[model samples]
Target: MVGGMHQRKAEMARHSDCFIALPGGYGTLEELLEVITWAQLGIHEKPVGLLNVDGYYNYLLTFIDKAVDDGFIRPSQRHIFVSAPNAKELVQKLEEYVPVQDGGVAKLNWTVEIEQPPPPPTPASKQVGFPALKKAEIAL
Candidate 1:
């Protein structure tokens, strides 16, 4: 087994060219989400897929659709991952995926302008109370 959970995930992500999620519980879901987030952030160009055997992921798919409808997820961003009913189809979809060129243009900028507040004045070193400790005094 890998030495640590994060180390395992990093190593997996580094070595993987694609990510697929089979029917599973929380760990599986978490891994799927992490890979998808990495793709969204341009950390990697790997394809992410879901194998929806026996309609196992139907509810999750519906939830994703709801998210898109609710505007929490952009419609273009929905193409970041693919889903299919079986292994063969899912794999085929992954094999055919082409990464989006520029995270897709945002449908709306959604910027809000508010009255500006002035920055807080910086406190002097003397006002901080304690003196800086030696490097050795700090524990890891």
Candidate 2:
């Protein structure tokens, strides 16, 4: 098993050329958002997709559209992912996707910047420790 979820996610993303989120619960949503976020940050150029599967993701897709309308998400950024009602369509969409040179430049009236937040303060009572383990102990 993977040592942790975060590490597993990173490994998966690194190995993947594209991402397709199937209909699932909270974990699925979280993973989908994380990959999209990484794409937004210019960390990866992979195409992300959603297999709608009987319109399961319809509400979520609508929410994303609402976010764009509310100025929270730029219209161009919406193209970061594509959705289709079935696996074949989604796969075809993904295969046809081409990464834009400008990283999907949004015609927004504002600028986007990466902000670094200050590190969290460590508690005085807790002691940080590292454990030695074999690489095979973790798998994604």
Candidate 3:
């Protein structure tokens, strides 16, 4: 009974271990929503994350919020999707995701946890061999 779309869903369903979604078009939205529906139905358990580079998904995330407020979606559904500004942060969020049970849905905390931050850069004053220049004086 699995058609082309079902086959695609199967591919996604098979990989229900780790999920990462990047900014995309209609196909991306459909994939994300279907996976989330499966999660809500207790058919799969996975960590789903969004890599929102350059504010791409800002509006979509907000629309999901509106969906919840308008009673078209449940608040617990928010746990199925998370948005991160970059790849590293997205991975970190996925790793730290904690699943919670609501009704029959597997929900994540949705609180971002940042780890493995890049080392802080050395301040200019602490760097060796750079002569400090006085403020540039301009001729009138």
Candidate 4:
């Protein structure tokens, strides 16, 4: 019974094994960035991935690198998320993702002891219903 928007997001993040942001506008980017920030702060160890279908996120990726180069984003925090062009590969990258151990910039109201990641995604991992997602932007 999550009542607020941010509350719902937190609830989902708590329950989710991984996060996969679909192709969309500001809301998608906001959530994606929030999760990455969480990982950077050692708040959680969940895998964050971006499904970069059809290069939709190419400029955004480049911008992120630029931020790294310009010192806006620390190099240590740059690799917090993984990306791929399709769902299968994205999921695989997610499966193999290792959380970054960054000393976060922002403080939070609550503390969560990051859990150990799940075992690797098996060959039978659920990689379905994503064929239509071939041209979407993502953050997982």
Clashes of each: 0, 0, 0, 3
Q: lDDT value for candidate 1?
A: 0.79
Q: In model 4, what are the clashing residue pairs, if there are any?
A: 19-140, 48-140, 49-140
Window of ten residues with lowest summed lDDT in model 3: 131-140
- lDDT, candidate 3, equals 0.74
Sorting all predicted structures by TM-score, with the top scorer first, yields 4, 2, 1, 3
Candidate 4 deviant stretches above 4 angstroms: 104-140
Query: Which stretches of model 2 miss by more than 4 angstroms?
Result: 100-140
Error of 3 at 124 (Å): 74
Go through the candidates in order and give the C-alpha RMSD of each one to the true structure. 13.2, 12.0, 19.0, 16.0
State in Å the error of residue 129, model 3: 74
Q: How does model 2 fare in lDDT?
A: 0.81
Instruction: Point out the higher-scoring one by lDDT: 1 or 3.
Output: 1
Best candidate per TM-score, number? Answer: 4
The C-alpha TM-scores of every prediction are: 0.70, 0.71, 0.67, 0.72
Candidate 3 residue lDDT tens string, 76-99:
868876779999998888898875
Q: How well is each residue in 57-104 modelled by candidate 2, as lDDT tens digits? A: 999999999999999987888888999998888999999987544545
Model 4: residue 51 alpha-carbon error in angstroms: 0.6
How much is the lDDT of residue 133 in candidate 4?
67
